[model samples]
Target: MLNLVLFGPPGAGKGTQSEKLINKYNLVHLSTGDLLRSQIAAGTELGLQAKSLMDKGILVPDEVVIGMIDTKLNENPSAAGFIFDGFPRTVRQAEALDTLLGQHNTGITVMVALVVDQEELTKRLLLRGQTSGRADDQNEELIRRRVQEYNEKTTPVASYYEQQGKYVAIDGIGEIDQIFGLICQKVEAAQSLES
Candidate 1:
């Protein structure tokens, strides 16, 4: 399995790059945000609980997020691999994910961290807001908060993976395809070593 964790701040183009990588490599794109949105739209019980917290601008409980991920993994047992985006936002979650995957005799093969300047991230997010109509992206304060949260919470998860020799940082300031090229190169290198 070629499981990967695509890590980056909001507007760092992690989502865009993950899409391209998935298309080119035949990896399942498992975006936590998209999954949560689906759950919310479906009005599942987990969605209802998460919705209340999200509506108030609070983080969803880790357990709730993990439960959703567990469900998805169970449903996609036959998938070749997965590109996990917007997940394992903390070291605790990272450890939990390791345990979950280990139970299946699989583990994360690589962690790709997309590095972009804060200014560029803000600019991209503002433009994305115009097209995406996402309230969080449209509001500058919220976007800043989200970026700060990612730094405080998610960055350490990258370091954790780095200690395990599974982290690869990619420059995220360029055309979409350019950024993806860097990522693909790193992924191919990592997979070759494993093979």
Candidate 2:
């Protein structure tokens, strides 16, 4: 399996890159944000519980997210692998994910983070807010908070993978194709090491 964690702060082009990576890798794209949104739109119990928290830019409880992930994993028994986006926001979540994957005898292949400065992220997100229809994206304060939250709460997940020698950082300030190519190179290199 070629499981990957496409890591990046908000507006770092993770959704865009994940789309391209999934196209090439035939990987199951499991974006927790998308999943939560779908559930919210469907009015599922978890979604109902998460909507208020999300609107406030707070992460949902780990157990709720983990339950959703378990369901997704079970749903894709024959997947080539998965591209995990918007997940493992805390080191604890990363550890939980490790345990979950270990239960299935699989593990993360790599966590390839897109490193972009905060200014670029703010610009990209404000631009995105215009068309994204995402309430959280429209507020500059919220975007800053989200980025701050990621830095404080989520960056450690990279270190978690780094300790395992599976973290790669790619420059995200460039043409989309160039960034994609760089990511592909990193993924290929990681997979080779895994093999």
Candidate 3:
């Protein structure tokens, strides 16, 4: 299976690229943010829990998020593979993911980190906020906090994958297709190495 993780700061176009990759490669795109939103919209137990934490500008506990992912994986056991987006945001979650996948005899094949400048990210996010009506994106303070949280808590996960020789960094600037092409090249190379 070609299990992969798409890593990037918010507004780095990870969602856009993940959707395209899923369509082209038949990979299941599992976005933690989307999953949480779905649960919230559905008024599920997990959703209620996460909603409260998110409203407070605090991260949902790792255990809650991991449980949600576990459910998704169980429900998609026959899927070809998965593209994890906006997940493993903490080293604890990354470690938990390793254990969860290990139980299924599967491991992450590669982790692709989309590199973008902070200024560019901020501009993209503000634009997205205006278009998407997402409250988090609309506030510069919140956006900055999100980026800071990503840098402090989530960026280490990339190094974790790097230590395992499964990390690939790609430029996240330019046209969407151009960035995606760079991602595909790295993914293909990783597949080749695995084979």
Candidate 4:
């Protein structure tokens, strides 16, 4: 299976590119944000818990996120692959993910990180906030906190994948199609190795 982790901070275009990659690779999209949103919309207890932390621009607890991912993995037993978007935010989460995939006889093929500067990310997120109506996105202070959180908490996960020689970085400041094309090249290269 061509499992992949789409790595990036908020407003790095992971959602936009995930759609394209899913269509091209026939990979199931396992987006933690979408998963949490569904739970929140349903008013589930888990949703309420996630909402409290999310409202403060904080990450939902790892166990909660992992449990959700486990459910998704079980729901799709014969998936061609999966594109994990906005997940494995911590090295511990990455290790847990590796264990989960191992139980299924597969592993992350690559981690493609969209490299965008903090200032640019802040600008992109503010523009996105205007339309997204997501409270977390609308506030400048929250957006900066989100970016800083990613830098402090999530960037280390890159080194985890890098140690496995499965990390790829692509410039995220460009035409959408152009950036995606770069990602596709890296993904295809990894897929070839898998075969």
Q: Ten consecutive residues with minimal summed lDDT in candidate 3? A: 53-62
Q: Which stretches of candidate 3 lie over 4 Å from their true place?
A: none
For model 3, state the Cα shift of residue 73 in Å: 1.2
Query: Measured by C-alpha RMSD in angstroms, how accurate is candidate 2?
Result: 0.8
lDDT of 3 by residue, 1-195 (tens): 888999999999999999988987899888989988998999998889888877666788888778878888899998888999988888788899999899877878899999888888989999999999888888888888888888898778988998999998998998998888989998888888888
C-alpha lDDT values of all predictions: 0.86, 0.93, 0.88, 0.93
lDDT of candidate 1 over 59-102, digit per residue (tens):
78778777777888888898889888988889999999899888
Query: Cα lDDT of model 4 overall?
Result: 0.93
Which TM-score value belongs to model 3?
0.96
Quality of model 3 by C-alpha lDDT: 0.88
> Can you give the lDDT of residue 67 in candidate 2?
88
Better of 1 and 3 by lDDT: 3
Report model 4's TM-score to 2 decimal places: 0.98
TM-score of each: 0.94, 0.98, 0.96, 0.98
Is 1 or 4 the stronger prediction by lDDT?
Answer: 4
lDDT of 2 by residue, 45-161 (tens): 888889989888889999888888999999999999999998888999999999999987899999999999999999999989999888888999999999999999977888899
